[model samples]
Target: MLCGKSLVNNFYKYKRKVWQNVIPIIKRHNATYHPPKILFFGTDNFSLPSLQALHRNCSDRLGVVTSFKSPANCVRSYAEKEKLPLKKWPIEPSDCSQFDLGVVVSFGHMIPANIINGFPNGMINVHASLLPKWRGAAPIMYAIMKGDASTGVSIMKIEPHRFDIGAILAQREVVIKPDVFMPELHASLALLGADLLVDTVNNVQERLKEAKLQDNTNASYAPKITNKLTEVVWSELSAFDIYTRYRALFGYKNLTTSFLGKQVQLLELRIPERELLVQEPGTFKYQKQRKSLLIGCAQDSQLEILQLRVEGRKPMNAQDFNNGFLKGARSLNFTQNKLSAN
Candidate 1:
């Protein structure tokens, strides 16, 4: 039989073990007990997930600040529907001081120093690309265009005037699948940014304490997409290059070239499984049996163009295009240069 003192000692040991196991769970619960007051700056559908997450997890999401160009006013519409406070862009400094932190995602404007200073914890941005790489408005598009094998999201401090040069608070990487297109990549990165943003916000002060300054020297930029990028240079671009560019611009823009003096938009492109006989780049061979158009490209590569649209006409499959446009021409070729009207 145990003595009273032994019984007391055994009870204390059991109590200590139970507390050891319970303390971490209690700490985790307490960590989120007091949600911070947050002012969210965002625009576009890409920013929606993060906003929704913060609203669901935090009690004090003060309001949303967005630009006039909110991609069909998606963010604004969501804010209004949810009855969340919504403010137009160029938020006043006077109104910002009450927030504990500012979270910016795809906001499209640089927050002024005064506005950033207004928040007790300053402002942090959720960028779509890994810091020091593809830092700008169209990171996802650029990542696809450049054939990057991997891309990611970064939670960083927002510096005035400059963009994507902020100190990184956290980063998360994702693989770029060979066949992934713009919308898929964009959605993946958006969700990743949202997940990382929530974690950073939950322990923002500690994260800020350990923030790492970005290495500007090693940085690369992803500028806005322009029409000029859609023009395909068949001679200079490989099948992979054209296909990747098509994937990158999918749903945003179409790969365009000049076909027999007419503007032709390559609607659907693919890398051909088998190589074609060495031919001059920009020249195409219509495979009547397969109903596919094979365009010669750099380094003996060939691109299979399945769908296309001639300027002033509706989109059509290769078979229809060949039957109507080709008219049984012996040799047909595409060119990058738009021919001058005679």
Candidate 2:
């Protein structure tokens, strides 16, 4: 009886081992079943880099769609240069019957609903912000403007006529450093988006099944930047706020202020160590010892100008600008012509 019991136990153990091996084989087969076709959309510098990276990595399964007009004209230029076969169409073209899935990075215009729904697998957008937080035009700039300690890239589904309200596929967080500028941040986010995109595509089935909806309550819009928005409001803002504004609008537009009946561009700025109790907001105070151009703000902190430009003049340091323009002038003016022309 004891020998018979031992034989039964061994037989049960052997059966369990066989089932364990078979289950993993079944799962592996399931995992290898399908790979979706992907379409890339965009034409700006940011989009171009990500698209190029995606094509290089997933050339066999990716297609590209871009605009045939100005601003997004680089799409055509890159396609010709790289010999990439691209489908060029106007922003609201009537037909989009080609792709199974779409991925938009920095496509300037809003994609119509028909084109978005044409993809059976659905479209995904790689936004530069954490989503539900910074949505709309300039997320990167908005994040920097808000002085966020950290920001991330989100891989979200494309929903028609909505602003970042789709389900999220994945997100990769990036830490914001004090010295990191806009160009560096932009590049980093683009690369992160490309990587996250590839991973999302690879795991589409599972991610789609487990997608999470974004919270609309936390949503905020980042409007498109303009010259008017770039004007420095010294009377209402602090030095740190001004500093962040400068970094956020750098490369795209220069921050402007009034000086001697002309708009003086605030090229580079820093916080002064010594506080001045006597200066009023928008007052220009020079620190020749530190070679700094100090502009007073609403708060105790001051904006130390490193470089600036006057109307019809090249950008110069505070000392050089002071020596040439600000010395003899009384109150400078921030005119529409002086601010917008450059």
C-alpha TM-scores of all predictions = 0.90, 0.83
lDDT tens digits, residues 62-141, model 2? 66778876754776677767766677754333334555677888887677787887777778888999988898889999
The lDDT, on a scale of 0 to 1, for candidate 1 is: 0.87
**Worst 10-residue lDDT window, candidate 2:** 332-341
RMSD of each: 4.3, 6.1
lDDT (0-100) at residue 285 of candidate 1? 77
TM-score for candidate 1: 0.90
lDDT of 1 by residue, 1-342 (tens): 469889999999999999999999999988857667888988888999999889887855558888776368778888888988888888799778778999999988878999998988999999999989998889999999999999999999988889999899999999999999999999988998988899999899899999999888899999999878888888888889989999999999888898767798889888867776666898887888768988889888888889999999999999998889788665598987573221
Deviation in angstroms for 342 in model 1? Answer: 15
The parts of candidate 1 lying over 4 Å away from their true place are 1-28, 69-71, 328-331, 337-342
lDDT of each: 0.87, 0.78
Backbone clash pairs for candidate 1 read: none
User: What ranges in model 2 sit over 4 Å off?
Assistant: 1-34, 71-74, 91-98, 274-278, 331-342
